[model samples]
Target: MDFLTSSTHLHITAWVVALVLFLVGAFVSKSKGIHMALRLFYILTIITGGALFIEAMDYGMGMQYGIKFLLGILVIGMMEMILVRQKKNKPTTMFWILFAVFLFAVLYMGFKLPMGQNFLA
Candidate 1:
């Protein structure tokens, strides 16, 4: 119970939930319900990410935090482009590639990288 209230725990929980939602959304692309769920999931992701950014800034992990924030924004932008642009094969392929790179970067920052070490430590 106490762990649930800890900042590090909360951050991890948020990221895990976001990642799961992203995977589910991607896999269930044929369903409108899943698409809507993805939108809501993304909203939660943004909110939690913003909170983590603020915490990082306050504690002096600014560089890592900034990088993560930029990556998140880029991912969201690419997704928006994919959704709004005409359904053409070339554009769709390009968008998916960009999104894949963005996802990789986000995972690196969120997991493999030491971005949140200061807070977690």
Candidate 2:
């Protein structure tokens, strides 16, 4: 468990790969295999994120980490909605918009957090 939560590298990589998977699922293919892979990545991301949140709580900023977790979940939900809607031949414009907004918020908060890499912070 310590190994999983020791650093942010794994967390970052998981989410980044999930983002790429999202992009591929968005415009490239609607294959079930891709969707399943994306879902797997989502789980990996949340697990890693939870580990980070526990670490962040040690900094005495639980609220910020909580908000980040919520936003991260929203981002994941939005991704799922977009892909599902896309498959159903439904409009995903709003989902895409929300995804962008939530993703930006989460990523910004991530970089601004104490444990973050001080990326553009």
Task: Highest TM-score: give the candidate number.
Answer: 2
lDDT string for model 1 (1-121, tens) is: 3333245556566556656655565544545575566566567667767777766665567888788888987887676556545323234668779988997887677664454445334
* C-alpha TM-scores of all predictions: 0.67, 0.97
Which residues of candidate 1, in runs, are more than 4 Å off? 1-5, 8-28, 83-90, 112-121
Clashes of 2: 0
Q: Candidate 1 has what TM-score?
A: 0.67
Residue 76 accuracy (lDDT) in model 1: 72
Candidate models: Cα lDDT each: 0.64, 0.94
Per-residue lDDT over 63-119 for candidate 2, one digit per residue giving the tens place of the 0 to 100 score: 999999999999999999999999999999999999999999999999998888896
lDDT of 2 at 30: 81
Q: C-alpha displacement of 97 in model 1, angstroms?
A: 1.2
